[model samples]
Target: MFKIISALTLFISVSVHAQTPDSLLKPSPIKTLTTQQYNALIKGEDQYGMGLVAELNGLPSPDRALKYKKELDLSPTQVATFTKLAVELKRKKIEMGNFIVTNETKLETMFRTKKLNESDLIFYTNRYGLYQGELRNAILQASLKTWQLLSPQQVNKLLTFKKS
Candidate 1:
C-alpha cells in the first residue's frame, strides 16, 4: 500500500511538472506570458512591442493603418490595398516564425543529443540570420507599400495616433 501511494505521488508530481511552462520555472523579470500571448508570438505578432523598423521608416504597420481608417479617410482603393498588405504581412510573419522555431528546435536538439557538427552549426546560424533578414524585409516592405499608398497628409495624420 505504501509503495502504491509513493508511485502514485511520483506520477502526479511528474505530470504536474510536465504541464508547467518552462518559462515559469526560470527566474526572469518577464516570466510566464499567457498561452494567447505565446501563440500570438508564434503567429508573428510583435508581442514584445518593438517598433524600431516602423519608427525608423516613419511608417505605420498595416494593422495600425487600418485602425484609423476613418481618421485617415482612406479611399476604397486604399482600403483594399492596406487590407491586402495586412494579410500578406500576417502570412509572412507566420511563415517566418515557423521557420525560426523549427530551426531553433533542431539546433537545440542536435546539441542536446550530441549530434552537432561545426558545418551544420554554421549553416543553421547563418540560416537564422537569413530568416531574420527575410522577416525584416517583409515587414519593411509592407510599411513601404503602406507609405507609398498614403498621401503626405494621411501619413502625417497617422503619425499623430499613439500606438495602442
Candidate 2:
C-alpha cells in the first residue's frame, strides 16, 4: 500500500510539473504578429480572413478570375479590365499593409519599452482598425469588380467549382 501511494504521488508531481503554463506568459517576438503573420504581411498577402468573406459570397478573387479566364471565355477587353483592377488592388493593398505594419511595429515598441498609455493605446488600436477596414474594402471591391466582368454562365460555373 505504501509503495503504491508513493508511485501515485510521484506520477501526479511529474504530471503537474510538465503541464506548467510558462508559454502563456511569454511575450511574442513581434507582439502584434506571429512569425507566419509577419512573413505573409511582408509578401503582400492577406494574413487575415478579410478577403475570404467576399470570396465565399460569390465573388472570386483576382487571381481566381485570371485562372478561370480561358474557361470563362473572357474577351481581351474583359481580361484587360481584370488586369487593371488587380494591379490597382495590389498597389492599394500593399500600401495599406505597409501602413498597418508600421503602426503595429510602433505599438509593439511602445509596449516593449513600457511606454504604453491608455490614450495612446486606444488611438493606435483605432488606427489599426481603420487600416484593416480599408484593406478589406479594397480586396472586396476588386472581387465585386471581377464579378461584374463575368457573364452569368461564368458566374454559375465559378460558383459550381467553388462548391466542389
Candidate whose lDDT is highest: 2
Best model number under TM-score: 2
lDDT tens digits, residue span 1-164, model 1: 99999999999999888875743543321223455454655778855444466756678777788999999999999999999999998898888877866777678778878998999999999998898788888887888888888999999999988876
Per-residue accuracy of model 2 over 36-63 as CA lDDT, tens digit each: 6665565678878778888778888777
**Alpha carbon lDDT of each predicted model:** 0.78, 0.81
Task: Give the Cα-based TM-score of candidate 1 against the true structure.
Answer: 0.74
Using Cα atoms with residue i matched to residue i, what is each candidate's TM-score against the true structure? 0.74, 0.76
> Cα deviation in Å at residue 70, candidate 2?
0.6
lDDT of 1: 0.78
Model 2 misplaced stretches (Cα beyond 4 Å)? 1-29, 162-164
